[model samples]
Target: MNLRNIQYPFLFEVPVLKHMAGFAGLLKRDPRGWPSDRPVVGMFLCLDPLIFCCQPQPRPFGVAHHLATRFPDETFVFLVPITMSLERRVNALALAAQHRRFQKTHPRASLIILANTRDEERLLRRLGVDVRYAPQNMFVDEGMYHPIPGRERRFDAIYNAQLAPFKRHELARTLPSCAYVTKMFTTWSPQLKRQHLGKFVCSLPYNHVILNDVTADDVVPMDHVKVNRAMASAHVGLCLSGLEGAMYASIEYLLAGLPVVSTRSRGGRDVFFHPDTTLIVDDDPRAVQDGVVAMKARALPPDYVRATTLRLIAEERAHFNVFIDGLRGRQVDRTDPRWSFEYAHKLARFGSISEFEALVRAR
Candidate 1:
């Protein structure tokens, strides 16, 4: 299994700045029972029952093969697409190559991926990667985010994302009233204000980056309840990124009962989107503005939005349970069918990646 024989462009593996940024982020990690190259755990179904969530990045996917060896039976790998791009298949091929080295001895392949879109499933399967159609956003915590009855809708739209350049804040600049629920890395807000916020009334309306009333660090994420409240303060939510992983904020908007105005995106955010509840507009300021206006005019009920979103999420969860049960020749849990999914939603988020290895080792 010489990977050099199967040549594909490692497009993302190069570029000096990308590698530098990745290295900087790796340095901040707590590398305990794992090497820096080992991928972070995105989430797990149950540590006791052993459903490991594997992060499918180029270097990390190779390490998953190493893990499959040590905990052969215990190492039930479940990959969820982190991005809507060819890098996914490239990373998976890296894993398949490494895992093949031991296939003659181990006799069974353990890699499985939960696909975010039909194309993701088709592409991975074509490359011989085990894939399933289970969008990662479905695993979001519905309990933490929901519509608040009669909450004041002060703005026409809310765009809850980091104030990073890729977010393209300018796309939402033309909206007559839009609130920004953003996490400020540092000085990005000043630039945003200068470029995107001339007469925009709701420019930088809410910055809850600090929790527990702490105003010191804008890098910290706001509490989920407060995030929901911020979403509820507007009539619609905006998805502005063109390429990224499943946009979690999009689902949060639906859970908060706000219709969504999304630019044409590559990510799997559309998995949970209902046509009536979500409007896909061109990636332009005027188009986004008109989409927001159209959504506001439609005035879809908050209850209906929330209920439909939850139902769609449950269907994916059901798929996960059935897949696991078939493997075990029984339900994930005898008493609770969705027992594996009971792991706290926060575990699925990679903010606590450094702590994940310690937790898995402890189990």
Candidate 2:
């Protein structure tokens, strides 16, 4: 019997099958890495994107690096930095080495690089392998951001992003005449909060998305609701994040036909360059103000924005399918170690829930 070739129905075909498979594994715990008895074409190792504060970027492999250490069965596909900070480069190299070591241990494992910058792709190729550039995707729940006919007076503009120091500074300079709506409040130190107040006191009306300063992180129901509501009423959207990997907020704004005044960063570059997408700005305040003014003067068509966003989303799906199609290339050995519970956790964290669940059922 070809044990690895056992055909199983899709998870949706019979939802109860997962429970049945779980009961079978009740007595004996599955091994690490190669937990699935079923065949796996190849593994996709996710690379860390964020190198700031020793943290990885949010997209590509969001919050999945910590889980990589625990699962070594699958090959890795990384999203590398282009012209990153020194620390970031070092961290990327470290992750590369880690993935390389795994490939060495399991000859079937491989590395596929998807860099954030075009330059990074060249660097990877010089290192020997041709790495592809994977642009970030910003998806929003459409129902949340759709505009209503009569609620137009509630807000002037929506600027939803982080409350970092540089971001606060940019907003102060860029949005002099624009009222700003943010999901963050006085969560930062008193001095920082005061700094924000000092800059935009006259030019902007600062409506805190989440009211309480300290509890901003805990739960911001008010802020969340305000963001959705503002999207409906706002004439324009703004995102001035200094560092980003596909701004989800910008995606929401664009989907809502509220033109965006976005900072020119690597993360936002791909999305903004699309035809009549959003107004691009630099770190300078004056540039941001000009972009906002331009947006107020003219907003892109709703159909164009929607089509672009959907097209990008389709591109992502196509890439995923292509990646999965190449799985058969791995040279599998039944004796190799199987994936563990920790590996499942890693996959789930990285938005590979379906892939992980497939592994679990394969056992």
Task: State TM-scores per candidate.
Answer: 0.71, 0.57
Model 2 alpha-carbon drift over 4 Å, by segment: 1-91, 105-107, 111-114, 125-131, 138-149, 173-226, 301-303, 328-363
Q: Which candidate has the highest lDDT of all? A: 1
Candidate 2 lDDT, 135-251, residue by residue in tens: 433223444555554565444456665443434434534354344444333334455445444443333345423222333132233444566666766667777755445556666
Tens-place lDDT digits, model 1, residues 90-182 = 444553444344354345445566667777678767767666777878777788888899789988888888645567777877666777776
Per-residue error at 318 for model 1, in Å? 1.9
lDDT of each: 0.64, 0.45
Query: What 10-residue stretch in candidate 1 is worst by lDDT?
Result: 4-13
